[model samples]
Target: MRATIAPQDPADNSDWDVDGSPPDVVIKLSCPNAQPAPPSEEVESFTPAWTQGACDVLSTDLLSAPIQFSVIDVDALFDDPIVSVQYQVTRADIDRGVMEFTGSGALRSVAFQLTTYYAE
Candidate 1:
């Protein structure tokens, strides 16, 4: 799995200076193989028990800031047990100077860990 970073606005170059100092950044995670398994009996009985896995962040270049993340989209592939997950990170989180990007895994048995970086 790979995480890609891109400016939200293509025409807005003010965020970056001549020295390559980016005022803000956004990080997105695109997992091609992520899916939720069948719920257990306990889950079925309770309030929709969703599988929880660990997404270990291996690395990041983002400065210490309060980063925000949200699930943007999910796509299920054909003839495969894997699904795709898209996560979005906003610039407001960067303004707070937060570092770590932590979240729970999607599937019941599957876990994910990703490394990311903040551009200069």
Candidate 2:
């Protein structure tokens, strides 16, 4: 039920920074039914290895709302998107527990897992 984000290279990925430095990276996951989830801890790296981020949606809500996954460069005044994608949850997705979807913009790889439970 943990998720990870690792940015790739400029030739293959994107240079999300503008100041000739590595971007201050954070992961964002949002859903229409809920307020935006809090941002993950900031890291300064062109290729950052971040894990167990702060973005997740309830299994029950997955079908009703789309989930947005974003990689952002956190700035003092504003944040810029590095890569973002909105995913529609399918019944198969919940059943599989792990999912991989196409990335938006310059990136090309994105995958994550979600844990689901049952209650009676």
Query: Largest lDDT belongs to which candidate?
Result: 2
TM-scores, all models, native as reference: 0.20, 0.64
Where does candidate 2 have its weakest 10-residue lDDT segment? 1-10
**Tens digit per residue, CA lDDT, model 2, 1-120:** 222334433434644555656678777777655657676778786545456553455667777777887877777787766677788878898898877665434445556666544434
Question: Best candidate per TM-score, number?
Answer: 2
lDDT per residue, candidate 1, 1-120, as tens digits? 122222221234332223343222111332222223222221111012223322223123222322223221111231111123343434443344332333233221212233343335
lDDT of each: 0.27, 0.63
RMSD of each: 17.8, 4.2
